[model samples]
Target: MRGEFAHLGDLPEKQVCHECIGEKYLSGQIEVEGIPATCDYCAEIETPCLSIVEIAGRVQTAIEQHYSMTPDGPDDYQSAWLRDKESDYNWEREGEPVQGVVAELLCAADCIAADILELLSDRFDCRRPGDPDEGETEFAHTSFYELKAHSHRDWDRKWQRLEVALKNEVRFFNQEVLDVLKSVFNNLHQMQFRTLDVAVVQVGPSTALEALYRAREFQSSLDLKKALESPVGELGPPPGKYARAGRMNASGISVFYGSEQAHSALSEIRPVVGSNVVVAKFSIIRPLHLLDLRALKTISFKGSLFDPSYAEEKQRIGFLSTLTDRLTVPVMPGEQEREYLTTQAVADYLAGMSEPELDGILFPSVQDGKGVNVVLFHKAALVEPLAKTGRKVVSASIEDIDYEFDVRHPEYEINTETIEELGGSVPMLPLFFDFDAHLESLRQPEHREPSLRLELESIEVHDIKAVVLQTTVLPVRVTPQRQHRAGHTESGEPKF
Candidate 1:
C-alpha cells in the first residue's frame, strides 16, 4: 500500500495501469508474481468465506414507523452463525475446525462489500420516505445514506472537518456525553444488538432526540435519555461517533490506497497493538465515528501516483524522505548510480560538508514491481554506537502471513441511535479523523485526562483519551534573544 513505482531496490518498478497509466499496480508478490491490471478485490481468484456486516444507517422517518416499516428490521433477524472452518485462525476462537476457513477480513473482501451494499440499498429505500437514492451502492456505505460514488472522496474530505468539530464540542459538555456513551456500552449486550463494529450518524440540528434501548437489560433507550433531555444542557451530540461495542480492541494500522501523494501515512502503530484493540481490518478508512489516533499509528502508507494522463507536467523530480527507522532506501543499484557516487566520492562529499544534525542516512532497500524502493535509515549512525555500548535496537521485521480466516464477529452497522444522538437535525459538517493524535494520547495519559486535558481543550467526553507517541526528535536549541522594549512595543520591539 505504498506509493507508485520509483525503482531503487530488489523489487522491479510497478507497471502503470492500462486505464490509468499514472496509477501503478503491483508487479511482483513474495511468491505470487506478475500481477495483472485487475483490481485487487476483483483479482483475488480464490473464493473467500463471506462475512456479512450490517450496521444502522440513517433513520430519517419517525422511530416507530421507521422500525415497523423496515421489513428486515430486528424482528426479521437472520441468524449470524459462526461456522467452524479450516482457515488458518479460528474466527470464533472457540476451537479448531476441520475443512473450512473461518472468515477473518470483514469489509476488505469484495464479496462482503458487495453483499452489504445490496442489503443497505434495501434498508434505506424503506427507511427514507421519498429517497430514491436508497438503491445506490455508495449511499449505502456513506455516513448519511446520500453520498454518491463519485462524491465519496469529496465526502471524506468534508468528513474530516466534521470530525474536528465533534471533538471540539467535547470540551463543552463532557460528563453528560459520557453518561450517554456509557449507557450504550453497558446495555449493548442486553439489547440483543451485539455485533456493531462501525456506526454512522447524521450531523445537523435536532431540538429533541429521543432514542430507546429495548432488551432484557435496559427498560428503554429513553431510560437514560431523560438525563439530558433539555437542549440547554445537551451541549454535546458531538458531531462524530462516541464509542463501539469493542472498538479499542479491534483498532489497528490502515494505509489507504489513494491518499498517498500529498500525505505519507507512516502513522505509529503502538496504541492498537500496545493497548490491545480488536481490529476491524488491516486498515480502518473512515473507521468508527471518532478519530482513533491510537489505531492510526499502527499503520504506514504512501499515496498512489496519479494517472500518468494527469501527470502532464514534465521534468519534475519527487523525493521521498526516510520511511521507518530500519528502512534503507538505496539508490538504483545498477552500475550507473554507483559510478556517479563511489564510496570514496560520497565520503569526500561528506567530509567537505559540516555535520549538520546527522539523524540518519538514506538507502534503497528493495525494487519490487514498478514501485519505488524508497526507504529511510532512521538513526543509521546511532546503530553502531548503541550496539558498541551493548544497548538494544528495537525493530519489527515484516513477514508475510497467509491470511485465511475472515473477521466476522463485530460488524459495522448504520447506527441511527448514534446519528440522532450526534445532532443531525441541524446539519453539521463532516469531520476529519485525527488518528495520530489519538495514538499519542495513549502515551501521555495526562493530555487526555478528562478533568485536566479536557478542561484545556474543553474536552469532557467520557473516557477522554489519546495515544501519545514519544519519539526523540533532536530539537536544536539556542539562547533566547533578549527583547529590547521601552515605550516601544508589546513584543519588546523599539517603537519609533
Candidate 2:
C-alpha cells in the first residue's frame, strides 16, 4: 500500500530499470493487492492474459506428453506421479493458483513452460497496491516447499533382506536439490511443512559441482546427441529428447502414505521407483560412458568463457579442466577396457576423490582467475515416501528443482585446499558417483572409490601350506579435520 505507483503512460518506454524490476520482485515489493501499481508492459499484457482454468488445461496436456503409464509405452521410463488417467487424480491448490503454477513450473519439463505466467488465476491475491485502510501495506512473504524421501539400508549385510535394509538405512539422491531445500528451510523459518525430517546426505558444494559437470558431459555426448536427433524406439519422449528416467539432468519423486498402500498402488505400476527404465538408462549408459575414454577426452565446451553471454558453459569446462589438471588422479581401470586418464575420466576420478586427496592437489594453491573453482549440476530425482507400513525405505524421484549458488568468497576457495595440503583433510566428503552407495559412503570413516574393493581368499592345499597373494590395488582414503569458510555450511559460519 505504501510502495511506489505510476500509470503506464507516465513511465518512460526507452528508459528501463530491468535490474530494479528484478530487485523489487525478489524483495516482495510487487503484489496483487494494495494500490494498483501500473507499469507500461504489465498493463499492456494484463487484459490479454489467459484464465487459470485454460492454463491448467494446457498443463494437463503437457503432463500427458511427459508422463506415460504403460510399461512398454514411450514414457515408460518416465516416473509415474499423477495417476494413469486424468480423472484419477486432482490438482490441489490454495492461497493462489498463480503461486501454484509458479511452484509447479519451477521444476516442470519443456513443453508447458513458455505460457506459465499467463495461467495465473484471476483471483490470485497480491497485497493491496496503495496505502491500505490499515496503518501500513502488508508485504507478501516468499515461501518455500520442499519434498524429501529417505531410504533405510542394512549396511552390515549386503542388502540380503528388504525388511532389514528398509529398517536400517535411509537412501536418497538428488543431492543438489536437497542441499538447496535444506538451505532455504534453514533460512526461512516460516516455511510450511517444517516438521518434515531434514536428513541431508553430506556432500560439499565442490563435489556436487564436479558431479554436475559429469552430468552435463553425459548430456552433451555425441551418443546422446545422435539418440536425440534420430528416432530410437527403445528410448521415450518426443524427438530431440532422451528418455526422462535415464536423464542425467532430471528426476521425479512420488510421496506415498504407507508401505502396503504404496506397494499396492505401485504394484499396478511397472518397476520400483529406483529401478525404472530411467534408472536403467543410467545404469547401462553411465558405465559405458565411463569406459569409453574417447568420449571423456573429446568433451569440449560449446562456447567461449571470456564472453559474458557464453561464459556459463566455458566457465564450467574451464573449471573442470583446472581441477582435472590440478589433481594427480590415477588411471581408472576398465574391465576388459583400457586403464587411462581422459578428460572425462579425470573428472570421474576427481569426483570420487576424497576431500583430503583434492586438497593435496589444489594445495600450494594455483589461481586460474576463474570466477569460481567449483560449479553445480543438479538432477531431478524422483522421491517416493511411503507412510502406511512405515518401512524405512528411502525412495528418490529426481525432479528439476532449479536452485544453485556459488562459493564466491575467496576464503572458502583458499582455505579448504590450503588446509588439506598442510597434512590435513577438509571435512568435505567425496561424492560417490555410484548412486546406490552415495549416501552410505558419506557416513563412512573414509570415502570409497569409484570401484568396489575386491579381496582374494587363499587356495587350500591338501597336504602342503598355501599362500595368499594380493592381486589388485584398492583405493586409499583421505582423512583430516573438516574446515568451513563463509557461505559453505548451514551455520554460515566461516572457519577460515
Candidate 3:
C-alpha cells in the first residue's frame, strides 16, 4: 500500500534491520554467538522488498515526466501505481541478487527520499515553472540529486568538506552579479525563487555534492543554458538574495544510506533540514515474514582499536607547525610567529589534506626506541611505524621476519656491543641478507623452520575516523639492511 507491493501491507510501525541486530550483538548490546554470514531469512524477505523500490522509482519518474510535459497542471490530478511485479525490473541476475545487500536496502530507501523531498516542497512553498526566465516550472523544489554506490569512506570525506564550508560561511557568488541575475529572474518569471530553497540531496556516496558546495561561482539553470547556446565562458554566479548572503542557499544536505556507519556520520553534520536521513525500507513494508527475516540478517561489523588523541597540546603544536611549513602561509614582515590562527582556517586546511597527508598526521613515522623495533615488513616493503611514541596497533603484518640466534655462529652472540659515533650500539648483525629468508626465520618456531603467520587485526572503517596509534619496535633477529636484487651481497659474513 505504501510503495506498490501488496506484501508491504503488513508494515510494522517500527522495525530494525538484521545488520543493526548484528551490530547490537557485536557491541555487546545483545550477547549471542554463532552468527551466520548471510541470513537466509532476511534475504528471502529483502528480495521481494527490492520490487517495491523499482516500482517507486518508476512511479516517481512517471510523475516527473508528466509535470515536465504539462507545465501547467493545476487542474490535473495525476498518480502513479505499479500494475504488475513480473513486468517490473528484475532484482535478480543469474539466480543471485543483482545488487549488494546494502544496495538493495538503498534501492527501497530512494522511495522514502522522494517522499521527504515532496514534503519539503509543500513546506517551502515550492515554486514550479511559471515564467520562462524565473526557474524550473516542472520541479518546485531547488535540489540537486546525487546517486552513487555505497561507500562509507567517500561519505565521510564529503561530510568533512561540507562541515568546513558551512562553518566558515564560505561565499560562492559576487553580490553585484547575484543582484543582477535575481532582478532578471524576477522580471522573467512570475514566481519568486529564493536560493534558500535549494538543497544538496545525496543518494549514495557521491562526488557531486562536494563540487556543489565548493564551487565559488555557480550558474543557474538559465545561465547554463545560455552559456551552452553562446560562446562566452563566463556566465557568472547564480542570482538570488540567498546567493549574496555569504553561504550558498543550500544550508543543508539530505543523505541516504543503508549502513549504520553512514547514518552515524551523516547525523554528526547539523543542517537547516533533514540531516538524519535514514531511508524507509520496503523490506519492512512487506509481509510479517519480512519482519522476522529482517531480524535475522542485520549483523554488526563495527570493529575497534586504540586511536591517538589529536587535541593533546603536543599534537596541536606539531600540527600547526607542520601545516604552516607545508602550506607556505605568509608571515608578517619581521615577525617569525603567525599573526592569526583562526579555528575555521585551521579546520579548512586540515580538511584539505589528501588521504596520505591525513594518514601521516594520524599515524606519523616512529623513531628508534627501547621496545622491540617491530619493523612491519608488509607484503614486500618495510612498513614504517609512527615517529612519536605512546600508541599501539595490533594489526597483523603482511609478513614477519625473524632473526634467530645461532650460538654456534659468532653473529648470533647477544653480548657483542659495537658502539657507534652516534651513541648507539652496533650489534653483530648481518650486513647483507635475504629479506624473505630473514622474515621466514622470524615466522619459524625453530631457527631452521620458517612459516607464515596469519594474524587478523581488528580494524574497522568507522572506528578509525582519525586515530593516532602507539608503537614499539618489534624485535627481530635480522639487522636492518637495504633491499637488494637476487644474488647480491657486499659483506663476506657478519661477526659477533
Ranking by TM-score: 2, 3, 1
Which lDDT tens digits does candidate 1 get at residues 275-351? Answer: 22111101111111211111211222222222231121110101001112112223343533322222222222222
lDDT values of the candidates?
0.23, 0.24, 0.25
Which candidate number maximizes TM-score?
2
At residue 155, candidate 3 shows an lDDT of 28
lDDT string for model 3 (155-230, tens) is 2343345434534555343343333223221211111113221111121123221110101111233332232222
Evaluated at residue 137, the lDDT of candidate 2 is 14
Answer with 2 or 3, whichever has the higher TM-score: 2
Which window of 10 residues has the lowest lDDT sum in candidate 1?
Answer: 314-323
For each candidate in turn, the TM-score is: 0.14, 0.16, 0.16
